[model samples]
Target: MNNFARSEKKRQHAAVDARQVLRALREMKQSERPSRVRMELPLPQAGVENDKIVYLGKHGQLADWSGGMRQRFRATRPLVDTLLEGRQANFAGLLEDAEDGVGVWACDGDITVLTHVADTTAGLLFKLLRGEYGSAPTREGAMVCVVNAFWTDGGEKVGNPWEFKLREEARDVLKAGSWEVVYCLRAVRTAAGVPGTIWRRYPEPWLVLDETGRVVLSKEGSEEPSSAEVAEALNRTANATE
Candidate 1:
């Protein structure tokens, strides 16, 4: 068989095996289960910034490593609990929040919501009335849903919107510590014909490309990228020569 056919066959076999394993696990009686089995997985750590790890590409396809800064979207403890409820409820809440003008960024591999802290809105208004607007509350954090896999009911590529679930294992892993979340910002034209920036996630480069293949950072494009992007790209170019 050709490489594409072989890869597809392998993926099908793996999916079948995974389903069988899940079935067997579910069928096992509580009394018959062993109590000594322990599972452990490596966790991503803070203070370990690897710019080369950032990937961008289409879902269900190979990703390209695009050097970028390791930006973390902070999330408070309470915000995480709400997102872990389930996909349906979380999605509903997302739409409701969006109606309130809350920001929601969604692309291929991930979806993020800029969640607010409880009572922050009312508290901010009260403070503003008292001329304390300078000290008003800021955006608490974001809820990030990292998509793991995509599946269709009819075995077709196109299907319903992707659902998210915080598995037990993932919950356990997240309990270890705080995880960094990155937000992608893009530039857009405002109603007044002025340039503005907004939170958006896209799978393509924000900067324009020159004739020599170098990126040109234009003022009309996305927000100013972090210096880390250039530094990391330079490091990789140097290493490639060596």
Candidate 2:
């Protein structure tokens, strides 16, 4: 069959959670309210007009539409089928899990999916094996750090402490050549009653071979060793230049 035929056949076989489908349709019923926008932004990068941006509902359901145009379109089975396919639709966070467990599409508050990504391509189950992770959202506990800093700069940065530090470090390394980009799957969660895995496109979550030949992430504050530990590791790696 042709590509169009294949796509049609796939949609014909598409299936999604029944409970999610019902809830989505119900939200559509509620979204038939009034509008509240003075002027619309017409930037494609802003995604004011495009394939839907989906958010995970409480019960692994999907909030089909957003902004002022809600309920303007029906949340039909065909729509659900298209989303399940994940091709044309813009899924900023939502995805298809190859492994079996709790993710953005979980039924309850439990998360158990294969996180061994970096190998599996699109259209598969989620699983956690090794070398890297994808994501699983569960409310275990959160952390707030009390770091002892020794600053080299004259000002404190507005973002994460790691960011300011990385900027300082990259100034020296980036002058050399290209960096070996590492692809990683960073685990993420949310407290907006919606939590799950978030696949990051940047190598900040993955292992990178730096100019000094050290494996590291740009801003994984806790995942990497402390500064003192790294100094020791580097000292050990250096050859005697006699």
Candidate 3:
């Protein structure tokens, strides 16, 4: 072959090799991207605005209630789909069996979905899960507080505690019905930040039961028991069990 022809062929081969490498890199990146989980959050009776769930305030104003669930709550698509189908019995059975039945965490007096103190994301989850607005309301039930201190490094920081309210209704078959109560005790993000903006999620998103015994993400923190103190108590309980 002529020298110029040989040079042109070499250039073409190099370009093809570069294109293949780029395609491979793109595929690898796509595979690395985590699959997003769908959450089963029911909308309030107030309905949606600007593609966001909203509720009418006591003062006749509309407030956005999407909160952290929209930004932070993560789960598998199949799990969410199952919950939506009204078939969370298996999941609930798993959670019930997941924890040892050696301890009890129950609530007292009237159940309040939100502390209504600072309107945190946890508070929003409690309201949405319990159907405090336009959705179905919770019936007679018991309560359990699930505390997770993993993010706090063995309860050092003490993430928020979740109130798992178990509601009960008469049915042909017996099942567990649960809901969540929210309290704004500790700030999920203590650093300086602007209002109406979602910061990092503190503690951890956990499973809780609603009025229908369906599994849902429980809200964080509480006003009365105090999330940090609750976690400490839970730690003590774990130690005692061990």
Runs in model 3 deviating more than 4 A are 1-75, 83-120, 126-131, 141-242
| Whole-model lDDT, model 1 | 0.26
lDDT of 1 by residue, 97-128 (tens): 33222222221112232332122122222232
Give the winner by lDDT. Answer: 1
Candidates sorted on lDDT, descending: 1, 2, 3
lDDT of each: 0.26, 0.24, 0.23
Which pairs of residues have clashing backbones in candidate 1? 73-181
lDDT of 3: 0.23
The model with the greater lDDT, 1 or 3, is: 1
Model 2 agreement with the true structure over 97-184: per-residue lDDT tens digits: 3231112222122222111111112112211211123332213321111011112222222224466544443333222221221111
Off by over 4 Å in 2: 1-109, 112-224, 240-242
lDDT for position 222 in model 2: 17
Model 3 C-alpha lDDT per residue in residues 1-242, reported as the tens digit of each score = 12212232222232232223223322444344211111112123222323222222221123343342221112111212222232121122111112221111111221111111111223323343455532322433312222210111112222233322211111100111121221111111111211110111112333222212232224443212333433444444334545
The local lDDT score (0 to 100) that residue 46 gets in candidate 2 is 26
Model 2 lDDT at residue 93: 24
